[model samples]
Target: MGALELLPPDTAAVLREAAARTAGVTGLVVNIAVGYGGRREIADAVKQLLRAEADKGKSIEEIIESLDVDQIADHLYTKGQPDPDLVIRTSGEQRIGGFLLWQSIHSEFYFCEAYWPDFRRVDFLRALRAYSERNRRYGT
Candidate 1:
């Protein structure tokens, strides 16, 4: 169970160096959002927007009208990554828990009774097969 928090300051730089040395990849955007809470992330984005408007001597209404999902997504750590096509939460947890809320607007979800460590490749394949068989009209 290797955690992302073990690295020190400038860990991104160190990781980039290590990746370059080992895998020959120089540019990478690693989002180590451990202990990341989605509600907090949204709150942080709002605070950032407020600070920006205050710095420019603007009003709250002006900022509110300009704010949209795209702006929020741009401010998010997972900005560039595509919204997951399917989100699988094992152990039968029937909640989104705010994971990629904006991005997962139309994403499919699959839940299983198996625990995280107990999940198998066959279970993953079954989820994919189920997704493939569904008529994903995206709420048409």
Candidate 2:
């Protein structure tokens, strides 16, 4: 499991410990967001990117010239992971509400009327089926 660094130090420590304990386990990586906000995450990523480039002795103009979507993505919390292909919004909410803003640029969405606690395996299957039926153009 992975989480944003914005959590309290004690909570962050617990998350780290959990990660260390699970490092050897294979498959089924679950990423949980704690005290996470997509806008804040993007802002934090940009801050880290600027700090890294500055430490590398790159001038502002040089950094600006070299910056790209991938560079920004590399600094994001979910770096090195593939973007989510399908996002199922529960609680009858049709909107994503700022979830995975940068990473979900091309994601497919499925809004369900049931609340998350009421969601079941059958609902998940339906979501998967819906995803399979789409001709995923990935923004063209």
**Which candidate's TM-score is highest?**
2
lDDT of 1 at 31: 33
TM-score (all chains, Cα) for each model: 0.68, 0.79
> lDDT tens digits, residues 1-140, model 1?
13345556576567657656766444433233445667876777767767877798878888788877677676665666776678877777988767666666788988877876698999988988989988886757
For model 2, the stretches where C-alpha displacement exceeds 4 angstroms are 1-30
* Count of steric clashes across candidates, in order: 0, 0
Which residue runs of candidate 1 sit more than 4 Å off their true CA positions?
Answer: 1-3, 6-34, 53-57
lDDT, candidate 2, 51-127, per-residue tens? 99999999999999999988899999889788988888888888888888998889899998888769999998899
Q: How many residue pairs clash in model 2?
A: 0
